[model samples]
Target: MKSSYTVENPDYQLSPKTGMTRSHYIELAKYLLEGAFQHIDSFDDILTFPLIDGKTYPQEDSPAWRFRSLEFEALERTFTLAAPLIHNDPETEIKGINLRDYYANLLYKALTPGNPNSLPMPEDLPDSTYQYTCEFGGLFKTLLLMPDTIWSVYTEEQKAAMVKTISAWGHHRTTQNNWRIFNITTLSFLKKQGYEIDDGLLLNHLQWVVSYHSGDGWYLEQTYNYYSISLFIVYTTIWNRGFGDEYYPEISKTIEKSAQKLMESIGNFFGRDGYINMWSRSICYRTWVSGAFPVAFMLENPNLLDGGWARRLCSGSLLQFVTKEEFFVNGIPSLGFYGQKDYMVQSYSCPASPFLMFLPFICLALPEDSPFWTETENDGFWEDLGDASTQTLLPSPGLMLVNHGKTGTSEIIPGKVYYDDPNYSKLTFNTHFPWEDQNPDGGTSMEYAFRSLDPRDLRGDDINFYLTGKTVDNDSELRAKFTHSQNMLFNGQRDGVLYRQAIMRQPPNNGVGYIIDLAEITLPGGVLRVDRTRLAFEYELTLGHFGLPHIDGVEATVEERKLADRTVMIARIPGRSLAFITYHGWDQAEAMTHDGNNAEADSSTVLFARKTAPKVNPKMEILITAMLHKMDDSEWTEEELSPVKDFTIQTFAPSGSPCGVQVNLSSGASHHVDYQNIDGLRTC
Candidate 1:
């Protein structure tokens, strides 16, 4: 874990939140780049390393194989190290390699037609357009951001050859996602260089991608992940600073407004401690979770980080990952998020996958006197809101984030459903406790499981989760042309409580769709879950509390307290405690232990509550309150567990079924939920 380069002195005055400064960033860049630099024998060698699992793609060397693209990931991502270093100080060197000279030589070698590491053209691999064009943005952005370092040093012939390779990706069929930005950025760079491209096509793509701006702040992607900030907003801001106004000013206006709005609330998503609400995929790009900070600082006025907040985030985000010895395997950042967690790894990820995270270092390209550097860091909302949580509802993507004041962690409630993986499908994702991987029983933290009708096994997303989903903002028509397996019927916040109403059709039994409403109100320790279940038939249901990372072999104590009205299940270790109270429905409680599945620890204990039956009523209310805490409080108070001092149910039927309901919590929070319009809910 010893770094080859180290930040010498601490700057607590400049950065109170994280103690990271300009020097820290430089040394950190050198430290990270050293991993790749050590493995590089010369500029001609491809930038890649062994996958942590030591597995190979099933289609290696075939046209479908993404091996070439994986190699490109290595080359373009490592450029992030040299990009700012060479620009900020051209004499930069790491591990005896002249950073500027090496990257300059690399640019030429990788762009020329015959180099081993050179990216394959679109025509060469017609099936995988993502491979042909995905990395060009990283390549061109470095050139554009600091021309003197790499691009300016190149000979005219070297530049021309690179352009030929760049220009060869004129336009082609691909997933209707971020590639629009990639294509547009490439075209904009070419046009800036006085090369000819289809202006109409560029404008068309420009207008098309602008529609992806979710009015609240996010630019939606297929996965609806962190790329919204790191890739979508970053590339959009870059293009706008370069060519947006000249090409299509009207669309540029809309883009600017969304970007500005994004800057306003983007930082709120990050905890006071600076950990981003890590709710979605590609967690391998660890620190890039806050990758939007650099772009916000790079932008002009209305980019809105109150006072030198970007540096606080940048520094904290970098430390959150790099400081962890487990974050690196051998030397490079691991292919997984926190450590070498197999659950977080996807087939597409490689050792270089984490390299894409280097985008945050682009802050190094900024001038010293810029506000991002000179001003003292401040904790924006954490300083303002004392002991309270902030629940920001983003309707465009059905994402609701609750920033806890005491825990210094963020919990996200997402509306979209991805049955294939808990990464996206989980009802809740906590910053401190991330999603558990490779859970065979489907009883993962912050997720649900239903016993199979066959009674042979536990069933999860594979049987019931949506194959794909998206919000309406993702499509240009105000509604997309294609159909998604699932959709967000409604996403809204009522009185500090974030709620998402969604319906899922059993994939095997398409006619057997069910409506479920997920709602939660924040607590000092954890948020309380109030779920409305409406199934056509009775099914055994199980819910899990946030998985507590088992620490230092300390055995957790499990106890069940049965009060007059409800039973609370408590499990606690020294530093942390996890409790589950099944308030409304009938249930049994237990704990599941896991190993090698969590990124934060070697093993974890996830407490679960099960509803064996609920009187055979199709209309049932299930209230399971769970709290996972880090002793911000000395001990669990009796009053804290019962946040809901009162719950008033209305509209009782003679058949003993409640037609509608209302909730009044002891914390002075309330919610009015009704099934009156449940059938009328909209779907994408």
Candidate 2:
């Protein structure tokens, strides 16, 4: 049995790595849905959840949520969980109501006129931006993915009402990003049913999404966070499965190729044991990572993945969250990554929102003969990176994926030019160290920052990529120039080193920002960063490492090492370990603590390094820092905690950053970083 399975009675034969076979999935799905299912008393009863008054997220009565209905959110999202379950077990019953029959009847009432809980169609709603437009797409996808349970069983009148409702929602407004895919999926289903749809708009959406394709799959060019997976791939596959052949065969064929390529790259996103390195927003939708697989397998796409590897990953991710005893709250998946993690919930989340985590269950709908079920499970990248680590450079998204073999950690370093919040501008995001709890008193977010001591800066918090240097100058909406990074280059990394550059100023505006270049080398334990500062010398710089979960009644740090110009701090419990090192160009290091500020633990601790430029400042300044994560209790070796073997800076040539610098590690790995040609690079 898989050790990750915290619950008893796990099956190993079908899934040597996860014990999550077709039948196992059926059982797991029932357990998960039971939370919402137990409250059902009749075929037409809407699933209602009690609100915690002012504590309600998205604020129940706020103007932003004027178009949102708690009842509709609770009912529709729960059906997302029930759709696949009923596909495999059509006769499933809950609280004396047939799961399939309840949804079909409830939806019919919701779409028909005069019902108390009837959903307002797109035109009738206050505006086209109604939440119902985003929420109703799943109903159409469910009807298409498994028609017998809802669509086929419906009467002619019931079918017409739902279709008309979907058709209206199809024409509603959409966010420029992934929301457009929802319209495509729901409208494609209507088109497949021989109904009329604006083919121009439909084709337009397909073309628009295809335009995002940045090569090597994932449409990876700058697609942020869960937008790449949950919405884009999920609905695209649903549209492809239901109508791609007859509607747009050429684009469908291209999507198939892209999906296959995406599968290979996404495989690295998960560790050997299957914990997905999650970053960015939508932290509540934990299992959506598994959405990548089943659709490809259902279509029988070849060369997509090793069947054993796919299930192992799907199962691994499921076990990580589902096995936690605290995963549920009040009989449903909590609005947090784990149980009641207030720090993990987004402001936009509603109570029943987490029910959309039904992707992994799609495997249950696959036939028994599929390789996804027959193949023996095996480790994905662990088979290759036994004791080493490597990084994948995705040029379009300007992303680097690091696979840490010894400790089962996945780290992503993305080249971000502009950001609205800290979530987007962090130097890196790691699966092991999830973005820390965003509390005021909590340790700060992981970033390479310039804490503005100058009262001139309008914003108070430490500067991220956008340095608000010489603050208080432009009072026009607290102006800070974008760190435009169109020049995110890969000129280095000939030997495991990553070199890149980004201009930090808004040209044409004549803003005062730097043309900064950054370089990194991924070691087995952590990443070594070489950051150059061209900002004015008065601003003090601070580097914040990933926050470590702190245990109550225990010391925040297990051990710490301090040198004249270097220091290392380590924190760990039984299962997770974290290390932070300030190697060079820093004056002081301190570990800060906060209460109830972590998603995974009760408290969190972070090592923050601070330094100001020397009195005799040069045109360019450099800082080096490293962070490591592990899953074991062993102490770090000297080599693992040692400073860089060598670092060279030219005394002459005397321009901004040295034209080229060589930094080496004890392992004989060397990085030749050159910024001489940065002037010729592209500007964003």
C-alpha lDDT values of all predictions: 0.67, 0.66
Per-residue lDDT over 593-634 for candidate 2, one digit per residue giving the tens place of the 0 to 100 score: 756666666777777777765443335667777877778777
Give all TM-scores, in the order shown: 0.88, 0.88
**Residue 613 CA displacement from its true place in model 2, Å:** 3.2
What count of clashes does model 2 give? 4
Please give, for residues 333-412, the per-residue lDDT of candidate 1 as tens digits.
87777777666666766677788777888788778877778889987777877767777777776777778776777777
Report each candidate's C-alpha RMSD, comma-separated, in the order given: 6.6, 4.6
Off by over 4 Å in 2: 1-8, 52-68, 220-223, 341-344, 437-445, 455-495, 500-516, 552-555, 563-565, 614-619, 652-659, 679-684
RMSD score of candidate 1 (Å): 6.6
TM-score of predicted structure 2: 0.88
